[model samples]
Target chain A: MSPLSRRAFAGAALASLLVACGGPGTTTGSSTSPPPSVSEASVPPPAKSVAALGRSVPVGLKIPAIGVDTSVMQLGLAADGTVEVPPIAAHDRAGWYRHSPTPGQTGPSVILGHVTVGSYGDGVFRHLGELNRGDKVVARLENGKSAVFAVTAVQTVAKADFPTDEVYGDVDRPELRLITCGGPRTGDGYQDNVIVFATLST
Target chain B: MRRTGLSAMALACAAVLAGAVPAFADGTASPTPVPSRSAEPTKAPSPATSAEPTRAPSDDQVSVRPSGAPNTGEVTPSSGSATGGLIGGGAAAAIALGGGVFLVRRRRANGV
Candidate 1:
């Protein structure tokens, strides 16, 4: 090809590279490697613990400043692995997955609760949406000790931006995440998922 | 026999070197850093940063009515459609007009 054509091609390729690298978290964000998993080979695994979201879960959740003291239940993915929440009254319980980590245990401990109950006064976790960075989420372990997590960051992700890797990524520090419905209401469903990312502070 | 044990240790070291460790007990963090071998370095979120309500989430809220949107003042955990459908004006107009004329006549004839 002529020098001009070659130069133009080079510029076009450079532009594409720049665009890919310019976005948020493009290289260092949610799209990175998945968090750790439980296997025979996990180097330096955290700890072995258990909670239940099926028929059992950890005790209630409380954040003093937020006035949120609700039960948490164990939650999990259905057959397809989409998030499965406990029934409405199941709030104030941590939805512990039989297969996932326990609160203050190894791996990601996922808990689901209702933001509100239909038209009622809202469920116990109703105020979960109000949690911000540095908020504390305390869960009483079956051992009588409380596992405390402080809110790290809060993001309102469109349902499509769930960031499965990020929300459930494995970190050395204990963490907490609060999920609820948000975004503009639509005929079919809510517009987005309000994902609150927190870390194990206490 | 010793060779087998040695090989197992080698693979474990490789997994660790490849940044194979995940960080949190929960599944919201990246792979665990293998001490000095971890490629990506990230600090555990500090415990004492006061709440910043106005600050944005990492990119990634509350009560709801079991509807398309969450109730106000509650957290919203939702996702967006990855691929958009045909939302062009033409499709919308056609959907409206095609059904519009048919339903209009029905309504008028049924008027009481």
Candidate 2:
């Protein structure tokens, strides 16, 4: 075969590969890891040594499983009384809910992000739903300390059926919840929320 | 003649690399670091301490709760495609087109 022909063949073959695997998360362990199956076994008691950290406002977050590393902003109640979200333009960043306990202070610390940013593309949490059990999420606090948490569960539920209590209720140990829009998008916006439940691993 | 083949091979590799960069960028974070210090108990008491139910010192201390879950679904509008797709798809298309043009040029050169 002519040298030119070989080059053309190679180019075409690669283009085909790019198209076949271009979609995000298609080739990663984060998305392909199978969910753990439950069997008819008795549940074990909660870990008695669950550790809690001192109060320190989080300033940054990193989830190695999904390649999320960005500064965290504080989120407070919006004027309508709902919790405020980071500005749309700040789509790449996640926000920590100031009203909740600081990341390591006990109770459930809430963090939120967007799945997709308007015209800007995938937001910081676009791959969050792919987090499997035991994936680590690190939150860097203002005090120069970091709190690392591990995924316990990841659930997607309708916005109307959000598990507020399970998310915000007081817990016996420090926990974290990462939220983002998910499910089908409609006129009212995304119909469901992706929530990742994590407990302090360190 | 040998130089032409080298250039063509270089072009093909560059195009493929452009398309593959983003895919590889996704999981390039360095290994997770160990926390410098374990979570020490907070020395200061929460102002809302009274509202919290009584619990042993080992229990997670209760704190303020949000009135409700955040309404963040609209942070990204529904009408637009991500910029990433446009850039990535555009690069791949450009590379494919460039390759085709190169092949056609080579054929014409041989005919001459």
Candidate 3:
């Protein structure tokens, strides 16, 4: 090969390797499309319904099934606009998305937590995938009432294919979504997300 | 001359990989540890006593209804683009390394 062509080839190979590895602020392999919004009429009703609780800030969460009893922190959007997770030092704590409906309110209430922290290990939702249908989750509210929800589903999906609409879409009754990272590890990060869907119990 | 080019390419690749390891780690869902923060013990605020003033329930109260109208004070999730920080860094590295290769070729052509 000509000297000039050899140099060009080397540069091209390096560029391809960099693209395959990905860089900061870039996500590859995940679907970039917007989540589909399901109409309210199309949503199935809860198996057992209860009255929605009035406005109450969630302060703590307890899931007896997975032995989770962590304090809930109010999480707002990060500067990048995605929902923020709890700080690493507080990995044992779960964070409730303040913008979503408060637990027990009529909509999908989101609570996000870490699955693990680098070196620190074992985040609050590390065992979140173990939750099953018919298990119980309790959210202690600032109003001195506890919102009880029964687990409806548990799913682990690739981070690139996160079910945005199904997890964040509006619902007819008060619903709760607990999210954390799980599945196979890709270098330092997990390749998938674990979500627990639940609804208020009668 | 070929050995020089090969060495340069190897060095560039090593540097890019070194920078990428941490960036990949940062891309995880795990929260970054902040220096000044610790997990605060959360306490549920004291419940209102009967002596507290009670306001009449307003129509805006969250209720179990068939309608899917958004609740007041609820923040809708943002449809912001996800951060591809790792990918962006990798792309930048590629461009930088490519530029370095061009610079070397230019120097050689000039007989520098």
Q: Encode model 2's per-residue lDDT on A47-67: one tens digit a residue.
A: 654678888889999999999
**Candidate 1, DockQ score (0 to 1):** 0.02
lDDT string, candidate 1, A1-202, tens digits: 4454445556555544444344432323332322221111212322432342221236667778668766555443343225556564433343543333456653455566655544343555556656655667787776667777766565656665556665566655455666676544443444456666655544
**How close is chain A of candidate 2 to the true chain A, as a TM-score?**
0.76
Worst 10 residues of 2 chain B by lDDT: B35-44
Look at candidate 2 and give me any clashing residue pairs: none
Candidate 1's residue-wise lDDT over B42-100, tens digit each?
Answer: 22111111222222122211110111222222322331221112223334445445444
Point out where model 1 deviates above 4 Å: A1-57, A90-94, B1-112
Query: What's the candidate order when arranged by decreasing DockQ?
Result: 2, 3, 1
Query: What ranking of all candidate models by lDDT puts the best one first?
Result: 2, 3, 1
Better of 2 and 3 by TM-score: 2
**B99: Cα error in model 2, Å:** 42
Candidate 2: misplaced stretches above 4 Å? Answer: A1-48, B1-64, B75-112
Chain B TM-score per candidate, please.
Answer: 0.20, 0.32, 0.31
Which candidate wins on TM-score? Answer: 2
Predicted structure 2: lDDT: 0.71
Q: Write model 3 residue lDDT over A18-62, tens digit each, in one string.
A: 665564224323433212211112234356668999978899999
